[model samples]
Target: MKKIVSSLLIVSAFLLTACGSGNTNSSSASSATNSSTEKTSASSDANSGASEQEYTDPSQLKDSYDVIIVGAGGAGMAAAIQAKEAGANPVIFEKMPIAGGNTLKSSGGMNASETKFQKEQGIEDSNDTFFEDTLKGGQETNDRDLLRYFVDHSADAIDWLDNMGITLNNISYSGGASVKRIHRPADGSAVGGYLVDGLIRNVHEREIPLFVNADVTKINETDDKISGVTVSINGEEKEINAKAVVVTTGGFGSNEEMITKYRPDLKGYVSTTSEGSTGDGIKMIEALGGQTVAMDQIQVHPTVVQKDGMLISETVRGEGAILVNQQGKRFFNELETRDKVSAAETELPEHYAYLIFDDALAKRAKQVDFYKEQGVVEEGATIEELAKKIDVPEETLKATLDTWNKAVADKKDEEFGRETAMDYDLTEGPFYAIQIAPGIHHTMGGVKINTETQVINKEDKTIPGLYAAGEVTGGLHGNNRIGGNAVADIIIFGRQAGNQSAGFVKQ
Candidate 1:
C-alpha cells in the first residue's frame, strides 16, 4: 500500500509539471526530479509490497474546455461521453493511473424500468411503479423529482449503451422492486465498468483527451462563479481554466476520516468501493459553497464477504441462501430489504453472521461461484469441519443446524419469518459457510442536483458552469438505495448533466 501511495504521489508530481503553469525553470527541474522519484518508488514498492501512495492534490487544468469531468468512474465517464456527443469539447481527469474507478469493481448490474427484458419475462413494471418502489425503499428521504427523472430516463440510457455497441444479456434480475428490473452485462462484471468501457471507447474514437494520474485538490472560483481547478503534479503546482467543470469523482466510501466523522458507525468497517472513493468530489464541491443532502445516510450491503472485504451481492439470497447467527440460528428473512436484514444482523451478539449453504446451492448461486473463482470461499465436508475452517464453534453450529432442521421439518422459519420448506436441507455433509458483515456500500447523499443534473447551491440556485452526477451528486438515493438504482442514477443523470452542460455552452 505504501508503494502504491508513493507511485500515486510520483504520478501526481509528474502531472503537475506536465500541466501546471508554475515557474518554468523550477517546474521543469521539479518535474524531472519527481519523475525519477516516482520510478524509484514504484519499483521499490513492487519489490516490497508496501502501501500505495495516494494522489490527493488536484492537477492543473488546461486553459479552457467546454467540459471538465472529474473521477473517470461510471458517472464521470457517462457525463463526459454525453457532453462530447453534444458537440462540446470535454476532458476527463482521473486521479488514478487506471480510468475505471469503483465502477470496474462492481457486479455490472443496472436497475431500469419498462425494458424489453421485463416485457419478455411477463413482469409488469412501469416508471411510476419504479418511482414508488424507490420512494418506499428509501423511506421517502430521496428527492422525488430526481427519482422520477432517473426512472423515466434510465431505459433510454440502457438503449443508448446498446446503440454504442454495449450488450446487455436481456435478463432482468430481482431487486427492491415489484418486478425484476436489474440488467447485467454479458461479462457479468458490474455494469459500471461496462459503461466505463463503452464511454472510454467513444472518448478515444473522438480523440477526447483524458489526464490520468492527475488529482484535483480544489475547485477554483472567481467572484462566486466557477472558474477552473488547482492541482499538483510531479512536485510542481499549476492551474487550468475551464468554461465548465463537472464533479463525478465518486463518494467517500474509503475515506476513514470522513467516514469516522460523518458516519462513525461505519468507521473501521470494511468497504468494497475503490480506494479513490475518499469523498474528493464532496469535499471539493462543499468547499465551493455546495450543500450536501443525506450526509449521515450510508448504504450497508448485507452480504459482503467479511474476511477480505469481498462483496457478495444480495442476489445470492434472492436465489436461495440462509444467514445464520453465531449461535447457529437462522436469523432474518433471506429476501428482506438490505436495510432490514442488516439491522437485524447487526443486533446479534457478535454483530457477525455466516451465510450457510450446501454444495448444490453454492454451484447454482451466482455470488458463491463468483467468490469461489476469486478464491475467497471456504468449503468443508461437514458442519463441524466448516465451522472449524471458518473458526466458528462446532457445537454451536451443530445445535443451530439441528434447530433449523426442526424448523424446516415443521415448515416454519419462525425466528425471522423466512419462507418455510426451502428445498435441499443442510443434511449434505459437504457444507459451506461464508462470514458476512454489514460493509459500507453507497452514500445516499452528495452535492444537491436538480432534474437537469445541474449543481445547486445551499439556496437551491444552480451553480453556473458547474454540474455533478453519480455518487458525487446525491438526492437519488434517500435514506436507502435500492439495488441496481445506483447504476440507473449514474447513467440517467450523467446523460442529463451532459446535455444540460452542452446546451448551456451553446447558449
Candidate 2:
C-alpha cells in the first residue's frame, strides 16, 4: 500500500496528468499522458476513451498568433476552439508532456439547469433555483454576478458541446444540487476524459495549433498591455508574441508549497488534483500586477481511496451510496456539501469511512465498475458479509442497512435529514465497500477575474490583453465548489474568455 501511494505521488509529480477539477485514478493519469507519446493523431486506448487529437511539436508552431493560450486542459482547449471560431488564430501550450490536466480524470458530470436533456427526461429545473442552491452550497460567499452568469449560460454551454458532437445527455444528481442537473455521457462514464476527448477532437478538427511540453514561464506585458509570453520548449526559452493571452492553467491544489503557505492545516493531506495544478497562471498574472481572491479557500473532497490517492467521485454518493464508520453505523447526510461531509468524516472515531453500496450501483455507475476492476472495492454476498469483510460489527451493519433501506422506501430520511439521492435501496446481494478518507481536491481561490474573464489588477481594473478561466480564476465557487460546477465553469467561462480575448485582439 505504501509503495502504491509513493508511486502515485511520483507519477503525478512528473509523468502522470492530473485532474483540472476532477479526481485521479492512476489509470486516468496514464491515459492523460498518452498524448505525449502519440503526438499526431493522439489516440488513446480504451482505458482513456480519448479519440485522435492532432497536436503540433514545439518546432512546428508559429512564433506569433492572435491569441496565445496557456494550458491545454479543458478550459484552454475550449478557449482555443472558440477563438478560432471567432476568426482569431489561437495557439495552445501545455507544460506537461500531455495535454489534458486534471480534466482527464473527472469522473463526475457537468452541471447545467434548464437544458433540453433535462426537459426530455421531465427533470424540471430552473436557472434561478440553481443559483440559489449554489449560493447556499458555497455558504453565500460566491460572487453573485459571476454565479448568476454561470447558471444562466450553463445550458448554452451544454448546447455548445452538443453542437460539437460531444453529447452529455445523461443527467444525474450531485451533492449540493437541488435537482438532477449533473450531465454526463449517455453511457454514464466519467465526464472528465469524455469532455477532454471531445474538446481535443474539436480543436484538432479546427486545425488549431496545440503544443505539449511547452511551458509558459512569463506572461509578458508591453506598454501596460498583454503582448504575449516567454515559453520554454525543449529546455530553450522562446518568446511568442500574441495580441491576447488567456491563462487557463488550472488551480494549485497539488502544490503543497502553495497550500501550506495558505492553509497549513492541509500541509500533509494527499491531493487529488493533477500535478500540473501548481497555480502557474495565477502566479504569472500576479507578477503582472493582477490581484487574487480567496487564496486560502482550498477544498478537500470527502471520499478518497487513500492507498492510491484516487478520488471516489461524489456522484457515487449522489447515486445512492452511504458512508458508514468503523462500527458500521451511518453518520451524516450522505448528500450534504463536500466541506460538511468532510468535517463529519473527521469527527468520526477513525477519521475515515467506507462508502457502502450494492450490485445495483456497481452496475449502474461506471466508476464503481472501474473501482471493482482495480481491486479497490471489497465485496461480500450480503450486508452482514460485507461488514465482516470490512471488520465492522455484523449486527450493527445489518441494522444500519435495514434502517437506511426503509428510509429509501419511505422517502424520508428521519435520521440525518438526507433529502436527496434516496431513490435506491441497498437490498441487492453482493454488497460492496470502498474505504475512504478526505483528500485535497480543489483550490477555490485564484487570481481574480471579472465577468468578461479579464484578469483584474490590484486596483480592481482589468488587465489589458490578459484573461483567465476555469480553476485559475477565483470568485465563482467562493468558500466551496459544488460538484459539476467546475465543468460548467470551464466551459462557460472558457467560451467567454475565448470570445472576449478574440474581441480584445480585434481592437
Candidate 3:
C-alpha cells in the first residue's frame, strides 16, 4: 500500500511536470527467449462437447483467406488491423453478437512505461521499473524474458493505438503496479468500452470483414500445419480457411467447469467476465496439441457485488475507500496487488469483505452513486449503523473504524501498513459500505507461445500457421496478471501475431 501511494504521488508529480507532451511508441519485437523446453502436452480431445464433432462436410469449408482471427475483442481487432495493414486480407470471427468481446467489459486502462503521458506528467517511470514491478507482482515465477519483452514494447503498443486513434488519455495508479501507468480515456464510465469503440471504429473505417456469432469449435490441422477453423455461424457449421489463424478468444473465467478444474476453491465465487470468455480458443488450440502453462494460476478481482457480481472498479480504492473483513477489521492493505488482497480476504470464513468510505471518496471515484443505483450500496449516518446494515457486529465495526480513524489521524496504518489515506475519512456522514469477495476475473494460463506470437505445440515446436495473443495465450503473465497489463498484453501481442502471420502468408 505504501509503495502504491508513493509511486502514484511520484508519477502524478511527473505527469504535472511533463504536461503530457512527450509520447514515445513502446512497441518492439519480443525477444525469442523462452528456452524452457516446452512441456506442451496435448490436452484431452473431449471438452465441453465441441472437439468431437465431425469435420467431413467439405461444402462447409469456406474460401481461404490470408489470416483468420477468432474473437473480436481488443486483441482480435488489433490482430486484424495489423494483418490488414501488413497487406493480408484478414477476417475476424466473433462468437458474440458483435465485435468487442470482454475487451468492451474492461475498465479500458492499459499499463505502459516511458510513455509521453508519464513523461508529460513528470513521473519517473521507465520500462525497466515497469519490468521489475511486473516480475515481483507475478512473484518472479514468470518468464523473465517474456516479462522483459512486454515492458520493453508496451509504450510502443500505446503509440500504435494512438496512431490509429484508439487512445486513452487519463492516467492513474492500479493494482499490482508500482507507478501510475493505467491509461484510460476521459470517459467518466472508465470502462473498456472506449478502447473497444476506438478499435471497432477503426475496423469499420478500414472495411475489415467482421463476422459476429461465429464460434470456432475446431481447429483443423493437416499434419503439423494449422490449416483453418470450423465455426458454428448462426447455428450452421462453416469452415473458414486461412494460411494463419490467431486465437484471441480470451480466458475461461466464466466457464464453471474450467474454473473448477483449475480452482476448485473458487467454485462458489462469482465471475466478473463475459460469458464469451469460456476459453473457446484455448480449447481449440489445446485439442490441436498445444501446451498450456500455469493452468492453475487463476486471477480473482478483489471486489464485486455479492449478488449480481458487478465489478466495482479498483479506482474506488485508488481514490479513498478501504476494505475491512467481515469482522470489520482491516485485514491487509487495501492497496496490495489484487492477488494478495484476495488471498487475505479468502482467509475469512465466508470469503467476503467490505469496502467502507465517506461520500467524498465516493464522489471522487465517481462510482458510489452508480453502486447506489445498482442497489448494492449500503449507507448509514454512522459507523454503527453501517455495520448493522451489513450484518456485522456493531461494536466490532466501531472499534475497527476507531482503529482506522486513529491511523488516519496519525497519518499511518499501523495494522496494515498503508500509505496516505487519500485524505478522506469514514467520519464523514452518509458513509457507505458494500459486501465484496474475490471473484474469478482472469485465467493467467493457456496456450504456450514464442515471442513471435506463434503458438507452441506440446513437442516444443511452433505449430506452423498458428498464432495467438490476449488472455488465451499463456507465458506472459506467469502467476498473476496486473490490472492494466491485460489491455497492454492483448493489443501488443495481438499486433505482433497479426504482423507475423501476414509475413508467414506472404512467404
Candidate 4:
C-alpha cells in the first residue's frame, strides 16, 4: 500500500515508525537492503569452480533446473525454506523490487491451536474447536478438506516459524476463533515485519539465492506439466526452466479492475493491500490451464479510515469502544468479525460510522494515538460535544451514553448485546472519535488448491509439477476469512507447498 505522503517533517518520523506501527509505511523496501547483502555473501561462500552461475545474460538460464518458486512473501519464503530442506536446490523469483509482499503490511497476528503458548496461559483451545470455528466463520462454505488441513497443521506452522527464529508470544482472541489464538511477536512490532525479517535471515543462512526484481511474467511449460518461468529482469526477458514451480504470489485486492470483475459491489471501496499484490501468480497460472474458485467471496474489513484506507486496529473496540451512527446510537457490537461489521457499515445511511472511546480506553490501547497523529480522529471534551463534532444530535448522543454508562455500571449490556460487558465508563472526559467505512481489505478468492497444496487445473485435476499456497490460492477460506487465519493460511500451506514441490522433484 502507498503511504500517505505528508510534509518532510512526518516522513522522517515515519521512516523510524513504519516498522513499529501498523499504520504507515511498508516493509517492501527493507528486503533489498539486507537481501542484496546476504546474496552477495552467499555467492562468495560457494565452491569456486562448482558455484551456480550468477544470473545475468539470458543465455545462461536456457538450461533446466530442479525447482523454481515465485513470490517472496511469507508463503514464498516458507516454501523456499522447506524446498531447500527437502534437498532440492530451488531458485526463488520475486516480482517486486524488494521481495516482501502484502505480508509485510498486515497488522493482525497468526492463528495457532493447542500450542505451548496457549497452555502456559491455561487457555482451553483445541484443533477440533478451531476447525469448527473456522467452518462457522466461513458460514460453512469453506472446503472441508482444506480447512481441516489448515486447522490440524496450524500449531506445527507456529512451531516451525519459532524454530526458524520468529518468536511469537502474546495471544489475543481473534473474532472468529472459539478461544484465544492470535499470536503476536514477543517484541510488540508488527508481526509482518518480524516474520518477513526472520524468514529472510533464515534464507540467507541456508545460502538460498533469492533474486529480487525478478518479475515473473509467464510460466514456461511443455504439455501443461510444470516446466519453468519467464521473468523480466532490468527490462530484459529471461526464461529459466525447472521441474516444479510453486506459485505463492499473493491476491489482487489492490487491482481495481479485478475487484470490479469479481465483486462489482466493492468497486468504489479503497484497498489496504500493497501495489505488488495484483494477482500475478493467479493470472499467469490461469493462462497455463489452472482454474480458480471462490472468486466472488471478497472480504471487506470495517473500521479502516477512508483517506488512505489505513486500519484503525480492532483493539479500539476490543479494549472498549462503541460504534455509533449519525443518530448518535450504537448499532452492531464492536467485537463482531470484519465481515459482520463491514456488512452493517455498508447498510448504514451514509455507509459509515464513528468509533468513540473514552480517555482511559485510549490509554490502554495506545495505537489509537497513531490515528490521532494521522489527523483521522475527532476529539472532544464531552459526550455532547463529541456528538456535535460528529454531526449527531446532542440529546440522542447523551441518551446513548447514559444507557451505555448505566449498562457499564450494571455489568450488562441490554442494547446491542456486547457479551464481554464493559471495561471502561464513558463518563471520563476527553473522548475520541474515528469516522470509518467498509473497505476492501483481503481477497478470499484466487487459484484453487487441494489439501496437499497442489494447484488444480481447469479439468478439475491436480496440476502435475505445480503447487500453490497463501492468498494466491483459494478454497481454504470460503466466503469470509477470519482475522488471524490469513497468516495461518499462508504459512501452513506455504510449508506444505514447499514440501510437496520438493517431493515432486525428488520423484
Q: What TM-score goes with each of the models?
A: 0.81, 0.92, 0.83, 0.84
Model 2 stretches astray by more than 4 angstroms: 1-53
Off by over 4 Å in 3: 1-62, 381-385, 391-411, 420-429
The runs of at least 3 residues in candidate 4 whose Cα sits more than 4 Å from the true structure, single-residue gaps closed, are 1-65, 187-189, 359-366, 381-385, 393-402, 405-411, 420-430
Model 2 Cα lDDT, one tens digit per residue, 194-229: 888789778877877777667788999888778999
Task: Evaluate all candidate structures by whole-model CA lDDT and list the values in order.
Answer: 0.69, 0.83, 0.72, 0.74
TM-score of 2: 0.92
- How many backbone overlaps does candidate 3 show? 16
Cα RMSD for predicted model 4: 8.4
Ranking by lDDT: 2, 4, 3, 1
Q: Considering TM-score, where higher is better, how would the candidates rank from best to worst?
A: 2, 4, 3, 1
| Reference-based TM-score, model 4 | 0.84
Q: Residue-wise lDDT of candidate 4 within 1-507, one digit each (tens)?
A: 012111101100011112211122222323332332233211100001111112222223435567788988889989989989989888777755544667766665798998888899898999999888888889898999999889889888888988987878777666666567888776333466567767877776676666655678888878856789887754567788898999998988777778889987777676767656777888888997899989988888887777776766665665568889888888987767789988898899898999988888777565666566667788889887888788999998889888988888887888777754265777777988899887777889889888888888899998888899999888887888888888888899998988999999999
Best by lDDT: 2
Ten consecutive residues with minimal summed lDDT in candidate 3? 10-19
Selected candidate, larger lDDT, 2 vs 3: 2
- Residue 455 of model 2, lDDT score: 90
What's the lDDT for candidate 4?
0.74
